[model samples]
Target: MKITSAQAWWVQIPIEADKQHVSDFGRLRTFDSAILRLETDDGLVGWGEGKNAAGSAGDYGTLVHLLNTEFGQRLIGRDPADVTYIWEDFYNGVRAGKARKAGHVMPDLARRGLTVAAISAIDIALWDILGKADGKPVWRLLGGAKSDRLRAYASGGWADKDNIGAQLQSYVDTGGFNGVKMRVGAMDGTPHRSAERVIAARNALGPDVELMVDAHGTYTVSDAKRFAYLVRDCDLAWFEEPVTGDDKIGMAEVRAASHMPISAGESEATRFDFRDLIVGRCVDILQPDPACCGGITEAMRIGTLASSFNLRLAPHLWAGAPCFFAGLHVCAASPASFMVEFSLGANPMIHNLSNDPVTVVDGMVAIPQTPGIGLDMNEAVIEKFAKKG
Candidate 1:
């Protein structure tokens, strides 16, 4: 069947917290996402979601406009089943030579940053359409099921200095997560403070529970190394994006200096960027987010690349529920995928946006067996949160 329409919805979902939370990038009070919906000639529909427009207030608008205009218009009457060709059309036709040569950073819908998020959601929606057309889930269509159950880590510990110990303890103690990740460099630019928070998290969780740290590309190589040294005693499961993601050499240096495995790739959007990261030995683990990295199709390719290098793929989860399930399916299909990320806080976007939201029980989650990504978007949630222009 031919693709009929592609649309983007911009919605601002409020966070359930009395005080605003802080991350390495910006404040986390409301989660704004650009959701994409694609329809085929036969009236079948697919849904996908992009990244959180936290810092850039207008990013959601840009995504919505781009998807509904250039990208949307270009895809009309095209075959949605040709996912690979469509990816190349956006990558080669829209990005690479044109944007890179001019240094204009063309609004290619599949590259890095905001535009790629739009591409990511649309790409996922296309896959959903394909899977729904067939009688299989996206993971099953990718290859075969590697495992029916996927393990997830509790992703929280924002505002590192603000009762982090209590926050971490509460996640594992009450939330039933297998592991927990906490932010490190958001408090101050000092490694000592990061070390202190790491120590607090470890002390609160004790030695048995798994603990991870994410600096969100906030530290220099030296500071990353220093903080890694200090947290070495804490036995961190991994150090995620210690230095900036673009700093391959610096990341490699930090990785070499630290005993804890370095995890990154959430900032990267394509397999080429992942190739650079893998070939450069920049990190021990790859953390690609499906929503930002060209969706499930590219994520599978990146997972294979990481496997060839003997590196583990732990899909990142910082977007909405659609993106989270997309990553979950990728993890379920790839045995090399170690753990998925689940936000450990009160995110109504995730909790209330899906009819069958994935839940963590004893730190593990089972993959949905239904067709496509096995989850449906809660239209009411979308309508309630749609930002007025």
Candidate 2:
């Protein structure tokens, strides 16, 4: 079937919490997610999501325009079944400027921002169309699942919260999460203060629970090293994006000096970007987000590359329902994938936007069994949160 049309919606769902949030990415506030919908000539429709942080962090408007105009123009007459070819062509159209004329070339990293994010949403929807058409789950289509369920870590332990210690304790006590990740780095005021927060979380969770820290690329090499050394006794599960994501050398240096397993790649958008990070020995764990890393098509490539290097993949999850399922399928099929990120906090989009939020039971999330990500989009939520013209 050929693609008929594509549309993007900007939805801002406010967040409610018992306490304040100062995540490494920023303070926890509203959930601003960009949703893409693609329809084929044969009447099959698919949903996808692009990551846009709360309070206009990402170029949401540009992403929406690209998908609805340029991206839609490119895919209208194309076969939906040729997922890989479509992905390559779309990448070329965005990055290479090939859509403008024949043999047009551009810089390698030219198309490396919200444009790629838009492409990711489109590519995922295309895969969903294929899975639904073939009557199989995306995981099965991606060479079958290695396990029925994947272990998940309770994500988002914001440092700004008043009861950071209690919040972490509650994750294990009530949410049944065996592992939990808390924010670290710049936003926590100072290195000593950040260390204090980490120590408090470790003390509260005890030794049994696996603890991870996400810096969200808020530190320099020296600062990251200092924080790492300060919390050396904490036995962190991994240090995520300790420094700027693009600084492979800094990442390697921090990894070496800290003597800890560093995790990155959520900010990386393509396999080419991943290659340098991998060969540079920047991290022990790779956290590619399917929503932004060229969807499942490129995420699988990133996963395979990580496996070859003996590096583990624990996908960084933060998008909406569609992107969440995309990450789940990739994790389900990848044996190297150890843990998936799950937000325990209140996200109206994730919880209210779908009938199924891929429930986590005892720190393990079951791979979606139904065809094509196995969850129906909640139109009601979309209508309620959709931005007006």
Candidate 3:
């Protein structure tokens, strides 16, 4: 079928917390998301979510306007099934400055957050359409190598530090998740107390269960080295974002100085950014958020590149709705991906948005067998919490 139209819907979803909490790494704030919907003349519809962080809503708003008003017109008579070709045309066309003069700014972190997010949603929808077109699942279309059951890690351990052990134990006991990651560096730059916390967790969980620590890019090189040295005997799976994402040199320094594997790149966007990381050998694990990192198309390319370098792909997921499903699909298709992240906090928007909410059984998540990301949006819930512009 030929292309017809593309539209963007910006919706606000509130977080349960009142004020934005400051973690040791990055600022935490809540806001609405900008969703993209693409439709073909034959009635195939695709969906995407843009990177809508705290103050980046306007960036996505502009991207949505450009896609709907400008790019949509250009792709009107083209075939929607040409996923790769269409992506190349759109991406290269923008680089060629065809859409740049049409009031669209060059993609930045804020712009890319929205651009990539929207692109990821559309890319996923396109893949879904491809699957339907071929009468198969998206994983099979991408050469399904593993089973549908994805090993899951119990995330969202941001409760009071005192309650962390109980919270982690509760998820392991109730959710049946054997692997768990805890949020470290809670506003304090020191690594001494945080290392103690890690030791305590190791003692509590014993040796078999996998435990990870996310510094959230909050520490300095020296601090990361200190923490890594203290917990070197604890057997952490990986140390995530030990320093800020921008500190490549610092990250490399941490990698050299510490025995633990360094993981990062969640704050990065596009393949160009990742190319630098890969070429520099800055990290051992690459965590690209499909929602933030130029969608599925780019993420697949990034995964391939990471595979070539023998790096692990574990996507960073912190948003609601489309973010989770999109990440899931990429993880399913990527051979190098080790695991998928799930937030354990009480998030009504995420729970109500998906027609098929994800289930984690025995520390693993079963991929949806349905069509088109294997999940449908809850329109009624969308309307109920829809943010007014």
Candidate 3 residue-wise lDDT, 327-383, digit = tens: 777788898898888777555545667787667888888876666666587877667
> Over 4 Å off in model 2, which ranges?
17-20, 24-26, 52-56, 94-109, 159-162
Which residue pairs collide, candidate 3?
48-121, 120-295
Candidate 1 to truth, TM:
0.92
Worst 10 residues of 3 by lDDT: 52-61
Q: Which residue ranges in model 1 land beyond 4 Å of their true spot?
A: 52-58, 94-111, 159-162
User: Against the hidden true structure, what lDDT does model 1 obtain?
Assistant: 0.81
lDDT tens digits, residue span 202-231, model 1: 887789989899888889898999898887
lDDT of each: 0.81, 0.81, 0.71
Q: What are the candidates' C-alpha RMSDs?
A: 3.7, 2.8, 4.3
Q: What is the lDDT of residue 167 in candidate 2?
A: 80
Please say which candidate is ahead in TM-score: 1 or 2: 2
